[model samples]
Target: MANELMIFAVITALLALIFRFTSLIVNSRRNRKKAVAFFHPYTNDGGGGERVLWCAVKAIQEESPDLDCVVYTGDHDASPQSLMDRALDRFGVKLLYQPKVVHLCKRKWIEETTYPHFTMIGQSLGSVYLSWEALCKFTPLYYFDTSGYAFTYPLARVFGCKVICYTHYPTISLDMLSRVRQRSSSYNNDALIAKSVWLSRCKIIYYTLFSWMYGIVGSCAHLAMVNSSWTKAHIEQLWGIPDRIKRVYPPCDTSGLQALPLERSTETPIIISVAQFRPEKAHTLQLEAFSIAMKRLNGGKPKPKLQFVGSCRNKSDEARLQKLKNKAVELNVDGEVEFHKNLMYRDLVRLLGGAVAGIHSMTDEHFGISVVEFMAAGAIPIAHSSAGPKMDIVLDEDGQQTGFLACTIEEYSDAILRIIGMSETERLTMAAAARKRAKRFSEQRFYDDFRAAIRPIMCLPYRNSNDVISNRDTDEERVCTTLYTVCGAAISNLFEAIHKHCVRAVQRGESSSLSWLGLRRAEYGCFVKFSRLLQLNEFLYKVSKCGKIFCWSFST
Candidate 1:
């Protein structure tokens, strides 16, 4: 009796799922307005990622005014008007379209507090849950992730939304695996792992497994865009998707910076570092390097002053800034170091124009927009000798070095000393070259590349639109249907095999017919796999129920 009841409940649930899915298909065929939904938790954060989000939205709005845009944000305190104002004030970007903001309460799961240890794996799993929440709230024709959350792609696809991801940096890649395996004395490898053999082995295993999982998740995206050549290489290697990743340089406000006077005041050389106060930015290295450079210039030469201009997103960032100040005092360069947090756009432009050179110490920075801005403002750049600066930005087309690259504090000090000692004519020549290189990553170029990359996907007709279905969507639907059909057929074949084996065993007058089948292990494995499939189906059913409740609430 219990077995019969269980079977009945399973059948009923399956029937309900089928009914709901059929209803959704019918609803999709209706003439509804289509929109692209952008999933970014911290849209108001004044960072490069925010710049990409706003620019992409603006580009889409300008290019196609018919389609609407909706942004899923975690910033619930700010209204649409305030967000628009902040965007304009911080980045000089104007968003003509007022996108609907859907506040997500579960976004805290992605924050560092949720994962004080093992942040990478924790945030990744958290993003999957966040994506599910976004989907349950509203289903869009296209799902776009400006942030580096590739884990959301599969969830988007399961809901029949095309997935597009702009990967600022890959979460896991070969370089990360190599760093763990080799136990190198670099920022990528932990000091404990590098020192202990057992810890190093365990970390290597951890990174290798995570890399495989990352690749699997990354391959689910239909299209991927990266910010720099270094990012593009890593994405292509780890994403395991051929010809899906393209390079679209992040937008930089070059015109405004370029309009500033090229000639800087030589009375007191100002060395500026325009980056967020994050541990990865290596502000400590900048302080130590500046101290060493000052010591080198003590031979009857005026010391250059270092200015740290950056955005502070939260209390942690503010605390980091204070700690950096303390470090400067420890180095006895506090008198020469100045910290500027969240400077206005105009003030930042003015500072950049008056500065002689810019310094960046982040390792493997994925496309240094600040470095590009420094160049556009006629400040020669001295950046870390890896990633974006090494592969894309600082190199000249004619095989000339546009700026300086350093790996160590001493190297950074020597580079700064060399820049300080250079003739004004040489400095001007280098600045001109750097500015010319930066123009390639201008806002216009970014718009063009972004449009080209997304055009093929966005132009496809949505299911809810009155327009006829494009070949791409039709092909995708056919492929998805065939996949389901194939899976169903495989399950049927497995059951049939078990049935035939059981019949043959019973006909031979064997009491233990299950053992006679010689397929108990295979049958158990199949049952486990099928059970997982049912659990996934059940989860999707619950999500669909939530979506229905939301839709009903909005309609009433």
Candidate 2:
């Protein structure tokens, strides 16, 4: 009887392994056939959103060969040496860059280095044309909004393509509203009018308007994707778009972050921070907190050494880093604080592994990748109490905090001090908890979520007939087409004002003024030519916008 029982248990275990393996294979197969076209504004810069876009493309390509992952982007003239190019290769996604985008990148460089007044007419014009071309070519384009919008949306619609956007944050919020109002006060009286005018015309106004507009487009999509639940709710509430918003958190490439079991050589503590040198990141706060912590913890022994590792791309970022260095000296923590840039990934990871804790000072960091990187490397995270990092990722079993969350300078300082004073066992426990928590956000989870979201959209029926424009048409068809072209163009041009800088000064979001002014002259010319067109009243009614000609009814 004992021999038979042992044989039976071995057979059952074998069967279970087979079942699990089969399930994984089936899921992998399912994830592989979704064709997705990604629209990235700049082909050059390697920012966080760009990273997300590339990861999704690479995952799709690896798992599903038939799933066409076409990347439509503005050319940034970025070479293999360029940071973005390296990331793109690391993911294995093919790229399609437009000349206009390249020119835009060139113009940005010029604006940065040489001429401050470089309007970049070529860049803007190239963007519009490329967008128009992308719309005409690609069927279902997914827009990633790290770059500006005005050029991308209208073209996508003209071609009858669906758009899904991964918005980092809502452009218009309580924060932006206050800023717009404050700026509008400087404009000649008519505070409400000026505010409204600025809001409608300005960059922020355009951003907010485009976000809501894109939300409408996102709703129309077979799928609406976002990074966090916080962003999902904000999009739904603000846009009032009745769509299914799916949460697919982007992944961090944490291939080899497991503990190496190497001995840490330092007798004193080590705290390190890794982020781009930016004012918004509030690296100064980390320095301030560290200064206080070191002073309090100092007992005639060598104090903890703090390292700041990150690159400075812009002048403002470089300036901020310099300012922080100065402040660190003033606080008398100059000897403890060290700033280094452009460190290799392995080196950074090794540093993280040796560190007692990692510091993050950025407020409301949307889905903190660096914090997770630190966690994966077994660094206990001491982060600001912000939206993405606080609510989404850092949580432990039994409802305990995974690591420290601080808001005020004193609170931040105290948290660092407390961590420093922790017993070795307590520190180890916190590090373990952080690592466990970060496991959920691994590359596998990201791949699974993204695959599921994209699968349905890929299965959508290809309606080639409706999208194609034929030369022959009936009188009624001609009239409808005319109306569509005239009205569509008018509305699109009106909306394009949301992207212009002049409009950013006004607080009102995307006012009719810019649209109206543009159409006024066009309307007069159209009135003379309307008699020769196929549909007169039908054309007039559809094209007319408050006595101005609205041309968008053309069938393409």
lDDT per residue as tens, model 2, 126-175 = 45566544444444433333343333444444334445556665533444
Tell me the spans in candidate 2 whose CA falls farther than 4 Å from its real position: 1-37, 41-47, 67-75, 79-85, 88-151, 174-222, 259-266, 300-302, 398-400, 465-467, 471-556
The numbered model that scores best in lDDT is 1
Model-by-model lDDT, in order?
Answer: 0.78, 0.57
How many clashes (backbone N, Cα, C below 3 Å) per candidate? 0, 36
**lDDT tens string, model 1, 1-556?**
2233244346547755865754553344332337788999887567788888889889989988877888889888867777777778888889996777778989988887688767788999999899878877777777899988888877676565778889999897777777767777665566877888898888888888888889988888888999999998888888877698889999999988888877877768899999988878999998999999998795666579999999887777889999999999899999999999988777888889888899999988988999899889999999999999898888874565588999999999998888888788888888888888889889999999999999988877554322222222444445544555565555445445554554554456443434433545456346435544554444444444334322322221
The TM-scores of all predictions, comma-separated, are 0.81, 0.66
How does model 2 fare in lDDT?
0.57
Q: What is the alpha-carbon lDDT for the whole of candidate 1?
A: 0.78
